[model samples]
Target: MTTTRKPGERAGLTPEIVFAAARELLAEVGIEAMSMRGVAKRLGVAPNALYAHVVSKQDLVDHLLDDVLSAVDTQVATQDPSSALQALMVDTYDVLLLHAALLPAFLVRQGARGDNARRLGDGVKTHLESASVPAERVDQAVHVLIIHTIGFAAFASHPNIDSNGYEQPPAVLRRDFTVGLKWLIFGMLDC
Candidate 1:
């Protein structure tokens, strides 16, 4: 038996494959199961083989989060800040719906290093500044928005972690979350 390559055959893998495998695994098993060994097993690679692509579990996690962030359509991030805020929230919540467990770890992480995190953070802030949000308050508002959106989804997804955790969400829960969001938007503060 022999393995062969045509001419320029790929390694049949990339950082993306590693990340996607991790994402799907995380969605299926929660963050606690996101070990490098697990990801390697899912990818059919030996544990040591993953080192060629990811430095450590943390590096793999950071890469996995980057893949998720890339999945979010951030057009709203470039639109006018007020509506952009709402739009960003909507999209963030959408991502949270599928990957809620990944939120706790990735939400506060700016990224691995210096400007990647700072740059991403600043670009988001620029929209707030562009919208004329009081310079002092934009950070606070972003914090609240992150909390509400992720917190809401985390609470929403909590029930699905049990052995028989695959039940449908109740209509009442849907109504309450929507109404709560509405109240937060219109009835609570005079933004």
Candidate 2:
């Protein structure tokens, strides 16, 4: 006789479900405490069950990164290159801020081989090219924008700094980000 499948035993598990559960677990316990076992526990599944969808913790993090990056609005690439680039950076910063807990993991796993990452990179490259930024400087410009945005986001999300009274008000922070972005854009154009 064949045994009946339990109602909640892996029958409802999907990569999306796993990702959502993992994200919640990450937010709740942080990266150091986040693990397949924790995610499985959150989903009410055996730890081994998560491995069927995500081969390892790193793989799970990568998938979550992809999901987070996918929310970045790259459609601005069709507009003026300078504004498009700045918008992209701002959008990236917003996404990073929303997932601040995962930023450290994202930084450590630098090489994210995912479609969303590629799309963001491609949008930046296309915008730079459209702006007539010299071929030799496009890569450098892209690096500057990405690195600066990520660095700023990481810095902005530091709770200690905010608690220490070193944090700027929201308006001041936006102005500072815009000024820095304008400087980078102009520098690229002048090169």
Candidate 3:
């Protein structure tokens, strides 16, 4: 027998719950195959029930990106602008690594149009300005940093294995990212 929800009756459904279910669904099936019906199946609800909270699949994906990015720490830890910028980038990398499945979404969406994303961008600009990066070059610097961070995280998320299938250790991956970030930061600041 099929059960239907009455009008205006949520049955404990909320945007948060929907987002959680959608994220789980994405993790299982990946972005290309994730759909409203798939999310509804995961949540034990009708597909139309999801529309009550999420407008469409793209909307759900956008919101998921923002939700994942909200965990990034945008705070500057040191007075030295370069160090502070590196810290922020490392934090971003860590957060993205944790939600590695969503990294492709970032590539397709060109980053989220949400508060958290704006905050991160603003933090990057603030650090660059503090480091005396020329105003005209700040945007370019920001792009370079973002591209590096995201690209590195996406590449590192996969198993870095040898011909014998021996995967590289996690510490090596992190060290490589930080070292590269440090070099990139110094290069941007010196110019």
Candidate 4:
């Protein structure tokens, strides 16, 4: 049986589906090798079909980055500013480590203007403000936190090419991140 999709007809394809496929493809081949055509091929659709949902490869990557950023747990589990900030930052670090493929995109986008990005920013800013971080230094603090989280995740995700036997396992890397995150939060909050 040979059923065919009409030209310009996407069948069941949706933006969500496209983004999902892109995420999977990125996870498999990384951002460098990921392409609109590659994503379309994965979905078994013509490459042109993706344009109906995404304008370009950059647009798709932007969406994917924002989509992943939405997963950051922003809830303040405790009223204590230091503890809340630590929790938020740890959650953010974990998310970045988990989706390391999007790290480059974050660097390019820089706290992307997407709604999810706005929400995450607002959440962090609220915590910082609550902690009485000086208004003049809040933005700088945010940038430092973003850089630290992304930078560390990128470093941790890189393959251990050291022939001199310097390798940190996942557990060690995670512990290091937690320790670093604690230092950043406490220093920023001065708590």
Candidate 5:
């Protein structure tokens, strides 16, 4: 028996392929180079051809994040939020170490409609919900956790800021941030 392949599948073009290629581009050429035109050229496809797989540059970015974040794994994240968060934090920190160009790009927000921000936000929200954290405070808690994680990654990586100033290495900053994160969260639980 013979099996048929999807139009894009045969060409090795799928949302996953788009995201993976984009991520490699992000690491190699920075976020700006991950455009549809660039990605198409990287994949050796026409610019319009990428549309069927990704809607926009923003869509590609969000999908890239989803693909990367999913690597953190649902089972581990679901087991214990605070602990899970700690693991997630460390894992993302490592990713940042490898993909320094994305430190700032990953931090950008597209407002309430932004999917990448919501991805991290919703993960923290789930943790709070499971912990029985107060509904009124869930949003706030999630905000703090997400910001702290992203900040820790940013300050941790400490990417070159327009080649003007230099900051401490991510490992050093993370040393302090990791300790501080644990202390802060532990202190909050006393409430």
Candidate 6:
């Protein structure tokens, strides 16, 4: 399905461009509705042209997610272990909320294949260990923190929640997230 590129249209076509377009499309239409053709159309390129950068739709999604995760600042890991972990959770929640449209896809594809995800996981595990969490429980603790952050972002961003008459204001949601995260951290430390 390859076609001759129109002058000036595909001149600057690159993986970065493709990824940015895909991310925008994902945010606008969601994972289920996003398509290579749609992204290509968004970029003013032929659908097959995207294959030069992304092998398939799944690859595009993976790249998009990795890009988003890479934006998270995990430097809080350098601070006191427990406080660092709490900070990381709060930061992660904010990042996920910023890309709330992608949370559902991210939660389902929990496999940490991307470099950013691996680095974030490593930081969390290291912090947990530094906090003196049992070696056997480090993995569980990390999973709990990650799942809780993603779950809250996903639930909060759902459209039907407002129509269902259970909507909480953003301030209240943030307060609840902080309270719940604190409790989770306390429980992990107590164990």
Among all windows of ten consecutive residues in candidate 5, which has the lowest summed lDDT?
Answer: 109-118
**Candidate-wise lDDT, in order:** 0.62, 0.81, 0.87, 0.81, 0.66, 0.82
Instruction: Return the clash pairs for model 5, or none.
Output: 156-170
**Per-residue accuracy of model 2 over 1-191 as CA lDDT, tens digit each:** 97765433345788888899999888888777899988988887788877768789988988988888999888883568888888998999888888888777666775345899889988999999999998898888888887777777766677433556675665666666778988998889777
Q: What is the C-alpha lDDT profile of model 1 across 1-191, one tens digit per residue? A: 88764211234667677778887787778666668889878988777767767778878777766555554555563455555655665666676667666775554563223333344355557666776667777677656555676667666666634356655464444455556665554422345
The sequence of per-residue lDDT tens digits that candidate 6 reaches over residues 1-191 is 98876432355688888888998898899889999999989988778888878788898888877777787778873667878888887887888888887886787777335788878889889888988999999999999998888888777676434555876787677788889998998898888
The stretch of ten residues in a row with the least summed lDDT in candidate 4 is 3-12
| Backbone clashes (count) for model 3 | 0
How does each model score on TM-score? 0.66, 0.84, 0.89, 0.84, 0.72, 0.84
Candidate 4 residue-wise lDDT, 84-151, digit = tens:
87788778878887888777767666645577877877888898999899999998888888777777
Reference-based TM-score, model 2: 0.84
Q: After superposition, how far is residue 119 of candidate 5 from its true place, in Å?
A: 7.2
Candidate 1 colliding pairs: none
| Best-to-worst lDDT order | 3, 6, 4, 2, 5, 1
Which pairs of residues collide in model 4? none
Model 3 pairs in collision: none
Cα-based lDDT at residue 25, candidate 4: 94
User: How displaced is residue 88 in candidate 6, in Å?
Assistant: 0.6
Better of 3 and 4 by TM-score: 3
Highest-lDDT candidate: 3
Model 5 residue 1 lDDT score: 94
Cα displacement (angstroms), candidate 6, residue 92, comes to 0.8
